[model samples]
Target: MKCPKCNSEIQTENINIQADIAQCNKCKNIFKISENIEDVIDDNFIVNNKPNGTWYKSDFNKTIIGASTRSPIAFFLVPFMLVWSGGSLGGIYGSQITNGEFNLLLTLAGIPFIIGSIFFWSLALMAIWGKVEVSLDNKGGKVFTGISTIGITKHFLWSDVSSIKEGQANLRYPGGKGVSLVLEGAKRISFGSSLKEERRYYLLRAVKSVMNKNR
Candidate 1:
């Protein structure tokens, strides 16, 4: 096969699946590709993300990468969650023990507060520690995003996917952008908007390149 970047003859020995990369001797450009290098889009694309705070993984397997969902609003919500959860739980348990009885009216009144607290607290924590992992495997793609094992997973083959591009970001967080996967028709799945631009672009390119390679 010819080098995608330089269009020069590439020796078969230079293409090694185990290495997951190739270097063009003519232009001295490096790239990641499958056996059919010609089908690769932007073969010379470089991923510069490295040592990026707590989420950095020097050994970031190109096939699988995670984007964190951390947000500045989460930090602001920390104090609110503490006070809200304390009040909600304290009222429920205090009434139960003080009256020596689980008053249905008091319990019902506290339930909504408890639920709200839990929901917001969970969202806050997720914003702090949650991550979405995108993988290029199986028929097309697989995505898992969550706080630990308690998140969600999505699976879809390439045939079912129509477009992979940048998606809308949550307006609450300014300057945030997300990656969206549009299915064959109207269905769309979006994730990882809070990530940095370079990270999002890498994900978009990785998926598109693999998809083209499959085709």
Candidate 2:
């Protein structure tokens, strides 16, 4: 581009973005760039798909996404367990399951039933006493999943995140897909997507909105 005063050409390569100033090669004239520093703290983050009822908080620069296993499935399991116990105790309970008459082989043969019981019970336990949370900022993010204060946390830099999109898990459950981050190094990070459908999309869009503002 030509300098306004001397009409001498200036190379675009030498411009400083943050400094917002450029120097003319011939005249040594320093001129300010028209660019302005932007602040990402705004309501734009929530205008997109907002969650129906999951917990959320944002301090503008830092966004926190979280949910407890408070799904109705938790409540549903109560009646289910009651009905199962009522039926199972009538005959099968004393007859085989809680009875010493069943041999080790028979007990061993019911491993599938044991596993299924454990799965359902675990789900109920988590629903009553578990939480999953994510903290996102301009530079990095963290995901926490656990019961109460005990759980695992995964950390990642925003630069390492290639993209955020909806991803399907290998499981065969409904709403198995969730917002996931694709890393530059061929790894994937999922923030416990077993949440409701509204929360899933809200998380996807919020992450995208924050990352876009940083850009």
Give each model a TM-score.
Answer: 0.63, 0.58
Candidate 1: list runs displaced more than 4 Å: 1-46, 49-62, 168-187, 193-202
Residues 6-85 of candidate 1 have per-residue lDDT tens digits of: 56666667666688877777887677767445344454442343224223222323366566767676767777888878
Task: Give per-residue CA lDDT, model 2, range 7-48, as digits (tens).
Answer: 455678756758877677888877665521111223455554
lDDT of 2 at 159: 68
For model 2, the stretches where C-alpha displacement exceeds 4 angstroms are 1-50, 60-62, 82-102, 127-130, 150-152, 174-185, 213-215
Q: Give, for candidate 1, the lowest lDDT window spanning 10 residues.
A: 53-62
lDDT of 2 at 100: 56
> How displaced is residue 123 in candidate 1, in Å?
1.8
